[model samples]
Target: MNEKQLEQMKNGKGFIAALDQSGGSTPKALALYGVTEDQYSGEEEMFDLVHDMRTRIITAPAFDSEQIIGAILFEQTMDREIEGLYTADYLYEKKGVVPFLKVDNGLDAEENGVQKMKPIADLEDKLRRANERNIFGTKMRSVIKEPNEEGIKAVVEQQFELGRQIMNAGLVPIIEPEVDINSSNKEKCEEMLKEEILKHLNELNEDDRVMLKLTIPTVANTYTELIEHPNVVRVVALSGGYEIDEANRKLSENNGLIASFSRALTQDLNVNQTDEEFNNKMSATVNSIYQASIT
Candidate 1:
């Protein structure tokens, strides 16, 4: 939907729901949320979720469409394949749906990992298929190396090239500007983002649309920085490694901007928990974001 349409939906009670979970948990969480077997197996399940959510928003006066956004973060180690991501796009196509994709941002050298370019190419091919099948448009998000002056320039150049490839193939690229709350100075982080945005604007053509992600402590703060840059079509507020409720509250107040989340949705779902508990946590997180958007 156009921003005006989205605003209209938000004005009349809409909610954005985001699920921050590993790829392995996504199907189970959808099932726990009352996604029917037929819907789950068929191509329409994604749309069903969006359609059902829209109904809930319209019926609930306290919510708005802008309040609803859905997200999933796939861990690098997870065995879940690329099809899961395409399924997400299918969900996005339904009216009143916005989805964000998150990949792990390695902050420490031990945690840092790389996704091969080949996998990304495969993902693009799947995205093309999803579009051909009339699935929803989902945005892609990733974190590159942290920004030193030279590193930022190189990353921006590489991202611009990648963005061109993605747009050429007809998909939205959501690039995460590296922000290490633990290591990077806040003012320096903000400056890096500003420079990156300027770089993107200089490189992007008039027809190009780019979705950029940033990790910020609050929605209000992120919105203030992002609104200053016209090229930034969406800004996802990072959850700052907090609890889901704290994250949701911040995102609720700043619902107009795109939001990305991680950790909170996945912390409980490791090898230790039962599938049922994992599903519950996932559903709760998704519902929490949905409810927050309405507030």
Candidate 2:
């Protein structure tokens, strides 16, 4: 682990930029960025287009360390370059932003009211390459749709188990067990999630720490204890499906949580915008999320 970036993460006041949308989510992400299905033909070309979008965002002036402390990259992005430097190096060296890699392949089919991550057949090799590429940490995700105790417990256990592997590989893990925003019993799901996370957090050794990326809870300050826990490096909130303004508002109400937004962060940007227009919109996006993070 890079001690400097770790310290920044422990105390940074800005939000994390979740630019890690994968193969499954790339089309929708591109669509919102004003690119349509007809824009790219095959999977390879689709990924190439999305990579171009990511490069544009990363190189924008407003996407700097001042208001965006960290960025999470997809594995493909990690293997790519930006302005003659590897993506992670470009982020930390040129932009002063810490970089993280999204390590999970994708989610499994829903079972027991939740969707766990699929088996990561190459997690070790991936982590090795991530470290070589100057990544500071990693993020992986699973989803919860109901408040079933057994289901939630399984989700948390799977997350922590992978988290330990990430830590042993010398990288912090952002353990995300996202509660579906549209779930019928969302509040109940969050309550159960909190309990499960706390149990695993308590079991960690003194030096073991991890980040949490959760869906913004129904109530303000719902994860206050998690934020204060010694084993938790930071608690970040995902936008789920909330619009930017609504996500920012909910984030501001939560005293210590910060945003790790994907869609909300890029919804205002379009593929056809001029560089000046894109940068201007990025400035506004960064400023709003930064304010909410600090509030």
Candidate 3:
């Protein structure tokens, strides 16, 4: 990513669509879209189908110029280009929507009060490939089901260290510390998450800059300091489990946060709709998300 691309990631209207769920989640999405299972004989085939559909959906005319400034793409889609165009080039080159790749292998089982990201044995290799492909940044996730100080510290520290590695590889990293929305300790967890993130940031050099894709806090606006911090680019918010209206309302309360929503952004679409109907629905959702982002 160049200086201009980096700036696009940091300072856009900041609505990013997350289409990076791993292979395991693809079938569920296909079924929801009413796709037939007879076409694919195995899991790999299923993922291929989903990738083709997802690529087409986002690249359709409806999404081209929406307020969505970036997309977090799964690896399969990233590797497959059309007639010499990177899968995301349609979004980035033509539409100015920067691209980010999901790095972590997903979460391991919870231990010592927090669940950490699954180990990626080839992360350095992966980051190198992503850089070569012109992906603007990377997003990885770790989960916090409850507020445990030791667990929170470990998660934040690990993310920062990995983020440093990513920057060294020449791409920004978006640290995703997600809290279970149903947890009674949501507010406490966010507070601890905030503290640990700040501690790590304070230890980094002045040249370090990264993005955060956090859950919408239980206490809205609690992360304004992060939003305003010099080393932080943009404080992006994940929709977590919130519905569209609720997600929009909660996100609007934060002064500088914007949406990187996945499910919420596509929640109301009817996958069975005709092409014209689908485009109209997709356009409306994009417009709604855009309003929430700018508010």
Task: Judging by lDDT against the true structure, name the best candidate.
Answer: 2
TM-score of each: 0.57, 0.99, 0.95
Tens digit per residue, CA lDDT, model 2, 231-271: 99999999999999999998999998999999999999999
Clashing pairs in 3: none
lDDT of 3 by residue, 1-295 (tens): 4788777667776588888877766776676566767757898788877776676677667665457788888887788874468876766777777888999998888976788988888899889889777888899999988899888888888889899999898888999989888878999999989988988888878988899999999887899888888889887888888988998988888777888988787666555788888788788878887787886
- Candidate 3 lDDT score at position 189: 94
Better of 2 and 3 by TM-score: 2
- In angstroms, the error of model 2 at 236 is 0.3
RMSD in angstroms, candidate 1?
Answer: 8.7
Comparison by TM-score, 1 against 2, better one = 2
Backbone clashes in model 2, listed as residue pairs: none
Candidates ranked by lDDT: 2, 3, 1
Which segments of model 1 are wrong by more than 4 Å?
1-66, 70-124, 133-147, 217-225, 248-258, 265-295
User: lDDT (0-100) at residue 93 of candidate 3?
Assistant: 78
Write down the lDDT of every candidate, Cα atoms only.
0.47, 0.95, 0.82
Query: Model 2: residues >4 Å from true position, as ranges?
Result: none
